[model samples]
Target chain A: MNIKKNFRVILPVGVLALAAVAWAGSPQILQPAGPGPSTASFTAINKVFTGDWQQYGQLFTSWQGGLFNRIFLLILTIVPVVFLLHYIIIGAKSFSHAGTPIKFFGILTRFLHWLAALSFSLLVITGLMVVFGKFIGGGPLVMSGRSVHLIAAIVFCLSAAGLFLIWLKDMLPMPHDILWLLIMGGYLSKKKKPVPAGKFNAGQKVWFWLATVGGGIMAWSGYTLYSFAAPVDQIRQMAILHNLLAAGLVAFFIIHLYMSLFAVKGAISSMLTGYKSREEVAIMHSRYKI
Target chain B: MARMKFLCDVERCIDCNGCVVACKEGNQVPVGINRRRVITIGEGKPGEKSISVACMHCSDAPCIAVCPVDAIYQREDGIVLVNKKTCIGCGYCFMACPFGAPQFPSGKVFGARGAMDKCTFCAGGPEKTFSDEEKQLYGQNRIAEGKVPLCAAMCATKALMAGDANVIADAYRKRVFARGSGANAWGWDRAYGKK
Candidate 1:
């Protein structure tokens, strides 16, 4: 394995992996309750609206339309630029292509991943267009994007379920994943050191769980939006949660795409052709036995 | 220029849903969609109040801000209107609207949302005034005929007021004075002698 070329790519990828962690953990829903309305007078007025969702109606819309949208835009803009910078500076990790290729993923896994991947990518694009609908100057095109978003969502949810079941055994937390996360799977070092991981790394495991469980919740939320089974307040709450979870999923997805397609040479072929370049797997998946 | 507005006096509203009926009859609003609704708070309690809800045509409309296509626009009169052709039925406006004004007709495909249908303040959309396309798409162009919105025009008790903001404010002020509910009831003191 070419350790020299490997570490060059790891530094920025590791940096980005850490950033996604920081962002995913920062949403207000997860934040602790603050000292609110300290004054007695202010608290008196708050009492009238304390239990009413209508009291916080404007708060929810403004946050969803204003702050949440901005954060999503930030994620879309920042993630790519960081990856581009890493590519320009450290360059892609090159692996030896001379050895016999290892049969890694089977057709079932590849089919499911592609199904999930393609639909998920479409969902992201269409979802963003809808989120930025006003800027796009609402029209038939945005309408079409929304239609496509629904279809893509259905496809993605189904594929993700299959993927969840297929990869459940490998995805469960192992002792090594903790170490792998701490070191960012050894991507930071300037050496091609085998990262301590199972067949799937900590990063991939995060994607697996997020894409499955998070996707399920998002699907349910999306349904709430469509069926309108619940009251508008409840639907609004669901929408907020949906948008927040999407940010985390999109962030991890970018990392996964970057690592699989560019972080190591020929890693994408493992999902497509079902064969991985032997040395590529050796360096990136050091713990996986061929 | 008249800044168009709608004000519903909850104190006077009897939950008769006259505005709801007038809107449906006048605009031919789609089935399962309400351009105007009478929401009664504390329905059976002593302090019960009914308020008609619809698009308020806000100056800083959130629907306009969030629409992917800028489909929802406001006229110089401050009446918010949406171009049906441009609307994609994404439901962001529905979510953003405080009254939940934006309505969606069920689509032929998988019961997906069709183009958004909303209260237009009785003014038509981007099409030519009084044209067939305008009538078909937006239902009516009462504003172009130099008339008040049908719901307000036909309101038996005038509980729902629509038109120039100043006039609505004046009427509302008089209502507060008559009901002895305004600040200090100062107008009542001068006019009717303090109670």
Candidate 2:
């Protein structure tokens, strides 16, 4: 083995080994007595509560927290939706040349795509934090960490709204979109059917519709729970709706990932480099002149 | 080594709010947030009784299980507390708690939900000694000074007792025997137990 190759591999392993040692030495759990009201230790606990009461005010009394929570959720839900819509509403091309380049929308769409991707990742991370609860921290820690998660979600929602404005036009259904859905359904059923030639095919159109509907549900329910402003019954109902919508999004992504990776090889290159090959363009979208 | 606990003899409680007031004065706790509150079970009824409420500080606290940031911690004495510096003010503990002990300073309006607030069992926060801010925000720094809670000491009727559970229970037993069969030893059983 080359010395350089050996050194590169050994360096990372060595760093990981040291990190493991350091982590092992970190403090472990040391439970204290049931902290009943003590004559002496009263001050510190009181300080924390004072600031918190002034900050939170009446419970579930305001809408700002709810708004912050809703915004990020909207972003996470909307961006994937836009991409799915484009893939469906805009025709998909199978790459004939392995290295060929194809162009969709130039710089503008690419910028929007990146924003959506970032927000989606944050939404998932922060969303999981909320769902899992304070297992990540003890009572006091969970109390504070929850606010950060909610704030990040708000930022995500704002970005999602921007994405929706930018890409909604391209996703409007055309005449062939409906036919493509039928033909695609037939193909999935393993039946003989005419291949679609249009700006977008049927399966892609279905994804767009799902995104629009699913995104709205996720946004509404997520906002409701984060705010905790609604009646207790309504909040619980919203929690159920939020989780269900999240599951739906995950299911949609699984199929999307499969189609992009193995089912249609070279499909991801367009997303990777923002272009497609001429042969793919002709085969997939012959009805529309480039 | 002791697994500490607080057991209030509800019958002895007078609903005078002394425990609540004692906690606030002793700890120098902030206004509008009572670390220990007096709760009356049967309001305006013959069967009415009150008990002082605070963190149960359970063995397997759900708040510790759900905190994503690892802010809350159980001390060697079994008291649970949050590292305010590390805490992100998320309120996950508030949801996990069965007793609604964890509270937030901010309410629902005007971004007041700035940070999470909860009872600290009179230990104050993770601050050193007692500064003016600490004194104002939390209350008295008596735990560091090695003292029992003020509420127990300030009980006018001598009903609320605090200390090691075994020690308090023994004290209560002696008091029951001293009554010489005239009064019900465990008041709850005599008044509410039988038809």
Candidate 3:
């Protein structure tokens, strides 16, 4: 029974994790030199096959050589500032409010929150510099900009893994969250009454999953773009997929930003100060009371 | 310190690799890297003519725009050069080059591409003087010795000319008007299409 319970929780989580890993294996650009100007096909796996895999790999190496060094420096400098600001400034008070008279984001929850924000920022900024470096400064400036972008992307991926671990507990599906989702929309629309929670509300749980799943795709495709050893056709396909995944993340982040900053009144302050009003907690998160 | 340039007369070229050989000897360029090459179009056909090609040393060089490490820059004499000390050998300039002038030292080792090398227009390299290092790495610095490019100066047929673009173009136009039947104004365009 214990094993069964564990499997029930592990199955979806494992699949989501796998999906995330696979998605990150996609590449950005994949033009490769082919055999003697006559052959331009892209093969799978090894040399028994014939085509553009080697060419794409060669191109990838050039891309890496051109940009990785400078990008790494920028990420090393910037991400710590973002991480420290989120953890120390935004998460401190929230942990104290878990079961207090005034409630807000708990310390554990706030840690995960800041982590997600940090990873997302790094990924977005670095990814742009790599894909669009040439299009930006034209000719000479493309080189410096591209290398800065590649290094930041690697840091972003590492941070994303941390964010995933920190939020896995809340992101798992719960019976209460399902019920809350069913009625919460109507309640907010005034067609039904409100339901509350202790640690996380149904709406919050939904947001958590969105970040988790979408982030996985972004990480996977981003990795594939960087690895450089993959076959060219596969890399090209991955590049397209990665672009799509990036678009999805951008849309999701917009909603995320709105909810944290505008839609919910005390959301930003909780991440910033880590506390919420007693009345606010009672009404919004009654089901999650510790 | 005027900007140096090279203008080739496509009409007079005889498909001889004379310029290519002269350039190789003058610069003592390393093997597997051709700073200049003669490309013969219409091979084995009646309307065939071969042109010796190298870097145009463009006023707005594409290689300069794409190097991340700021490796390539134009000299006051208008010759583009790679600062080999700063070059990381990334090969972006190779990809962006329309003329394929950038050659890497790839056949030297197990596909480990070397710093990019291209035609110096006979002005030589980034070194201060005609040191052995400059000779071995970037060929002879004839310009420092106050001479035109060896290939142009040594052309037996006088088919290829190097100097100001205006002077070369004037000579080419005179030839074209004199022999009006067979003249190609856009030789490069005819060679490599806009890709």
Candidate 4:
């Protein structure tokens, strides 16, 4: 009986010893292999910040060059074509008879408008060339485009600021804007509806906001990237934000160009000559007294 | 075809900065630009380790992806290179490189960045192989001469190895097996750490 009890005690002790050995020998806990807190050299900042920043770089390298670029190119081509077709199918709305022309845009307003428009158009062309010139053999074309883009960006920024200062009060959203937007700014109506508006219509207000706000962001981000003012990660973030804003600005530009040139007759003439025909104003902007 | 790569065995690196000097000397790299460097962690302390670092020539190089003018490209042998002729000095590649491999020479007085420069794996550039222009832009074309990179070849302790990926990997595997432990490749975790 004593021997049997001793045998039981020995078995339990042996099992415990074996288990201890196995646990001790198990592979180094397989710690996630990479730069730990002590080794990351890219950022003098914290590990979490650098890690998150690197993730943005990976995202941009993959999506910005691959999917985002392709989609933006497709949209860039299709949007202008679609707008052109839209104008051709439904011709511009024109007045039956020419009436007395009234002063619509002031001299300063007209100058600023043209300046902004000219700078914006140049920026778009040069920016597009910078982004897509490589596909078309980017030697002198891209080089020139970059130089032109820098100069145009400065003009665009100045004109955008000028427009914002002059037109902020005119472009504020009113309660009637909801109705104007609901009616699709009277562009879709079979019959021209007198959409009550102030100095600027809802559509024009939307364009103003996009141009001033979006343009400001683009200029700021572009400056930040060019200056290399921020850290590498921050610069990458700025690039991404700049590209996205550019795409949005391009879309708005297409619509604005079409609406001014074709959708509403005499809108371009008013922008050019600072006057709109009384009849045209009555039909297009009935709420605003001529 | 050999898929070329560099593997730095951190345990063997003595922080002597031998690789750094060798690369600069062999390439005649410009002042204030180091193609390779040795970074030591826990210096003058217990559990200290050092590793030599350079362009890893990544599989999907971010530099190539971000180049606006298609100035950067990777060779069939997986060496990342930049074409000086096409490079616009826009510095997009510099921001995109995860390893901070791209360097810009300080141009004028006001800290303007000149053309982008980096380790070319001793593979030269897009110019004619071993031509004068290639030598002027990129340093030496040691890879074309059927030789390994100078930095790794001249390593005093043989800490840095450069060759076909499979060959170096097998050699490193054998070393790890022989030691029965200590197989941690420093910076490997950082460059390609699993999420």
Ranking by lDDT: 4, 1, 3, 2
For model 3, residues A1-290, the per-residue Cα lDDT tens digits are 66866786689879877865775444433233232211111111112111232443334334434444344444444544553554444332221233555545567656655655775665566555444443353333433433544554455555556656765665555677766777642233422234545466766666666556555655565555444246444554455556555654555555566456644456687676777756546555665544
lDDT by residue for model 4 (A13-130), tens: 5885785455332221212224433233223221322254355777777766666577568768998888777677766787654666878888998998888899899998888876
Q: Which lDDT tens digits does candidate 2 get at residues B61-151?
A: 6567655566677876666776665565555566455445666565443353544556565556665657775565456756567766677
Name the better of 2 and 4 by lDDT.
4
lDDT for each residue of candidate 1 in A90-169, tens digit (9 for 90 to 100): 66787787789888888988898899889999998888887787677767777788778889999998888888778877
- Candidate 3 lDDT by residue in tens digits, B1-195: 444556556456786788888887767677767887775544565544455667767665657765655678888767788766555445556545545577777422234345678888776677766787777767777778888888888776777777755567677678867875434333323222231
State each model's TM-score restricted to chain B. Answer: 0.91, 0.77, 0.86, 0.93
Evaluated on CA atoms against the true complex, candidate 2 attains a DockQ of 0.07
Q: Give the TM-score of candidate 1.
A: 0.82
Poorly placed runs, candidate 3 (over 4 Å):
A1-89, A92-290, B1-3, B107-110, B181-195
lDDT for A121 (candidate 4): 97
In the range B1-195, model 1's lDDT, one tens digit per residue, is 988878776557788988899889888888998988776544465555556777777777767766657788888888888888888877767777655678999976678788888888889888999999998888789899899998899888887888987788788888888876533211112111221
Candidate 1 Cα misplacement greater than 4 A, ranges: A1-56, B41-48, B181-195
True contacts kept of 4: 0.23
Model 1 interface root-mean-square deviation: 10.7
| Per-model DockQ against the true two-chain complex | 0.25, 0.07, 0.07, 0.24
Residue A255 lDDT, candidate 1, scale 0-100: 88
